[model samples]
Target: MNKVILIGRLTKDPELNFAAGSGTAVTRFSLAVTRPFKKDETDFINCIAFGKTGETIAQYLTKGRQLAVTGSIRTGSYDAKDGTKRYTTDVVVDSFEFIGSGNNGGAGRDQNSYNNGYGSSNTGSDYSNSSSNFGGMNFEEDMTPVDDGDMPF
Candidate 1:
């Protein structure tokens, strides 16, 4: 009964690595998730996914991409270099879904093709920065330029 679900955008591409001992694939990434009511705040969640899921994420997901994480919340502690004990909280992801992707490089990089994650931007400008519209917006025309002559000079 330690399940947790999160919808957010990847702050950056997941750093794929293999366990030194087990040689199992693992991905470490941070998700920028915002509160439902809060306007100027966001929580950066550190996540770790393993095995095929981690490989898939590493292959497909990228910075600012949306993703849905279904996993458990795990907290741990470590000793700092200053000889002080430090505590950390992390989500050991069991499974995840690639939500929407931004206009970087991909066939699915459209406005409506937003990944499943929620926008966690702390900037007060707009929430349209991510693949999904966390700002509660409807669909709009594709911002990517085509050969249209509608420029008003």
Candidate 2:
């Protein structure tokens, strides 16, 4: 049950690199998420994406672009150059979605269901209004207006 979802703006451009020997793509970036209570306050969250997900994020996303990510929190400690143990915490991205339109910032597009295929599978469970047919079914097509008089609860 160690899952977290965040929707925020990119603080800066993502940094992409490959792991040694394995050559796995690794992208690191920060998200500026506004606090719920304080509209003026924001928290910069560190995020890391691996493999194809990392490459896609680094290539398509840019600074100030709104993004929604689903992942788990990871924490680690390392010896710093100043002879002190430094602790670090980051969100290990499992999947991501392009939120706002354009490279920088703008109004959100109708198709926010764009997934960057990190931990996705062909389970046929995805349902959306987007043009992309990842799942066979589009739940939007089967929707009907609910009447107040039909309430059973």
Candidate 3:
């Protein structure tokens, strides 16, 4: 029952590190989620993803890329060097989806086609040419004859 979903843009490139004992990959980043009603307000959230999810995020995502994350809130406290107890809250990412065009190498391609899981190896391709068709769907073709019975309305 402890789940959180957020859509936002990355504040900077993800920082990838490995656990010293187990060598497990961990990625940390911040997200700037804008308020729905308040145009000038935004919330900065700290997020962390582990294992393969963390690796994937570090490899393909970058600063300014939009993303949707589903995860749970984790809270903890640690003793600082100043001998003060510091409390921390982080979103432990369970899964994530790429939103809009990524800020990485695959430019001029359909951003939605880049959607993938944490373990997926698809790196995506560039489609800079105007004549290129997406998955064989021709935009110029007349398909008015297709039935509209499937419409829920």
Candidate 4:
């Protein structure tokens, strides 16, 4: 029930790290999301991706690139050196999709073709010139001839 979907640009390149004990990949970045009604206003949201999802994000995405992120909001609190309590809120990314064409070495290729799960070995050729079929229906196969006289309008 705590799902969040955001379409925004990365403020900077994602930082990728590994958990010391588990060696799990962790990627962190900030997203600049503009307000729908207020053009001049924007929000910088912190986001984190774990495991293979994190690795893919760090590998393909960069600053100024648009992304569609699906995740959940997580909030936490910590004590600072000044004895002040600081609260933090961030999106824990479950999945993400590339939004637009960029200089990420995958131009003119399908971005969504890359698998987001672990052990995905997608190459550049794997996404090149890919096409999507809407609703699993091929328009050419579903067409039916209609007569002009059948129209009531």
Candidate 5:
């Protein structure tokens, strides 16, 4: 019942590490998932994957790459050293897929290139370590303003 499926681009490259016990592989990353709106807002979700899925992702997935992840939502609570109770929750990914282009500014360009091994677009910028030039694809500017009167009471 706590299942969640998400398709989004990684904010950065996944941090892959090995657990102390059994040397199990663990991959942690954040995903920028947008809602169905024209505005430039996104929900950044914390994700973790273990075992083979984590290994595969760590090997092939890169920063800004689009992906589809299926996982279960988990919640936990702990006490801080300052005598405060903290609640934390995240999605535990079990499976995932390599979707389309990188979330870089040049989206469709990479999608066609990476998918077909031929890049036809003229992206003068490279996104090896960054996705800065999504070609003026400023997500924030695309948002539509909400009328003040539309506020729910």
Candidate 6:
């Protein structure tokens, strides 16, 4: 029940780091989600992803690129250098997808034409491929059809 789903744009490039003791990869970023009914307001949410997901996000995602994420809310507190207690709320990203038409502020392209063989290397495009790449979730290909005869509703 502690789930959160959000579609938004990256406020900046994801910062990838490693755990001090375990050396596990961790990436942190902020998402700017627009308010549903407000035109000029946005919510800045902090998000974190671990392992290969974090590495992929840091490698492919950039600032201002639209993204969709499913995760859970997590809260933590730490003592600051100034002796003040600092609190943080973050979305521990379980899955994410790249949005837009691959033309994310012209950051998806390089001087060369090929974009790591993903898709068109045009700098004008924000995403390269047609499929929405996702992380942290394994999609099964052999899904059985549900029967409506056993419906409880």
Highest TM-score: which candidate? 2
Stretch of 10 with least lDDT, candidate 6: 110-119
* lDDT: worst 10-residue window of model 5: 111-120
**Tens digit of per-residue lDDT, candidate 2, span 1-153:** 778778677877899999999999999999987667675677899999988778878877877776777789999999999999999999998776665454544333434443444445322323234442223433346323223232221
Off by over 4 Å in 6: 102-153
Write candidate 3's Cα lDDT for 1-153 as tens digits.
887877777888899999999999999998887767675677899999988778877877788776667778999999999999999999998766564554564233323322124222234431122331223444235222212232111
For 1-153, candidate 1 gives per-residue lDDT tens digits of 787777777787789999999999998999887666674567899998887667767876777776667678889899999999999888987655444444354335333222213223322322133443423432233223222122110
Off by over 4 Å in 4: 103-110, 113-153
Worst 10 residues of 3 by lDDT: 144-153
Using lDDT as the yardstick, the better of models 2 and 5 is 2
Per-residue lDDT value at 3 in model 5: 65
Residues 1-153 of candidate 5 have per-residue lDDT tens digits of: 676867677778899999997899888988877777533566889998887667666767777777666678988999999999999878887555454544343333332211111122223322232232222333235434333233221
The total of clashing pairs for model 3 equals 0
For model 4, how does the per-residue alpha-carbon lDDT over 1-153 read when each residue is reduced to its tens digit? 887767677888899999999999999999887667675677899999988778878877777776667778999999999999999999998666564554354343434644344222333322323233222333235434223232221
| Total backbone clashes of candidate 6, pairs 3 or more residues apart or in separate chains | 6
The whole-model lDDT of each prediction reads 0.62, 0.68, 0.66, 0.67, 0.61, 0.64
Q: Whose lDDT is greatest here?
A: 2
User: For each candidate, how many residue pairs have backbone atoms clashing (under 3 Å)?
Assistant: 7, 0, 0, 0, 5, 6
* Residue 35 in model 3: lDDT: 69
RMSD of each: 11.2, 10.1, 11.4, 11.8, 11.4, 13.0
Output the better candidate (1/2) by TM-score. Answer: 2
Sort by lDDT, top down from the best: 2, 4, 3, 6, 1, 5
User: Whose lDDT is higher: candidate 3's or candidate 4's?
Assistant: 4
**Runs in model 5 lying further than 4 Å from the true structure:** 103-153
